[model samples]
Target: MSSQPAIIVSSLDMDRIEALIEKMPRLTPEVEQLENELDRATIVAPEAIPANVVTMNSTVRFKFIGDDKVFEKTLVYPHDLKHDEQVSIFAPVGSALLGLAVGQSLNWPMPNSQSRTVEILEVLYQPERAGEYLR
Candidate 1:
């Protein structure tokens, strides 16, 4: 897994964060508070969607400039990438890819006022909600 900064999330792309949040073991009040702080730094990644978008750890695969492209591979998360796609846990687009759904777009700035858009065409898999659909 790349030490780069990115987001690691499961399912519910562009919707709910509770899926991954609920997976985390319950913690004490102090830990809970710290967890809140952690959320701020960590990005939330979403499941992969063929011909649309997929995020591993920090690495992100999406359609851009009218074509499919992979951005910031250094953030790929360690361990098996449960789905067919791989996302670096720490990448520019990985963190931003989470909590998003198809047809939605983000105009993120890339230094200066220059910015680009990321349009979600589809959400292929969301393990928590996918069920047999995953097969």
Candidate 2:
């Protein structure tokens, strides 16, 4: 089965989303349901998770659609991401990638019918000393 376990938005990322949902009452049922789903889901507090997190200067193994090779590149967190490698929280790929563990695979859908498969091989280091995404 696909490892993509429903996109659970972190509370830190949902601060703005919550406010926007409140202001925009015209949202459709599905959108409103999503907000409720997020509200119901307990956000895992930022703690030291046992898994490794991607950080600045951390080495990682990742794959993309076009490239046959499993690229080994040093990750630059919070910044320095290329179009394919660097993903921001607000970006589609970025939202899908954050907080992934090694050996975990996820299939993410693109705007088109295309899909991207991602797997984590190694997490060289964690930029955050504390938090669920760090360990």
> By how many angstroms RMSD does model 2 differ from the true structure?
6.5
lDDT of 2 by residue, 24-132 (tens): 6487543444454455444543443334643333456766645677766554323455655544333334433445566655565554556677666676554443332
Count of clashes, each model: 19, 3
lDDT of 2: 0.49
lDDT (C-alpha, whole model) for all candidates: 0.40, 0.49
| Over 4 Å off, model 1 | 1-61, 65-85, 110-114, 132-135
C-alpha TM-scores of all predictions: 0.39, 0.50
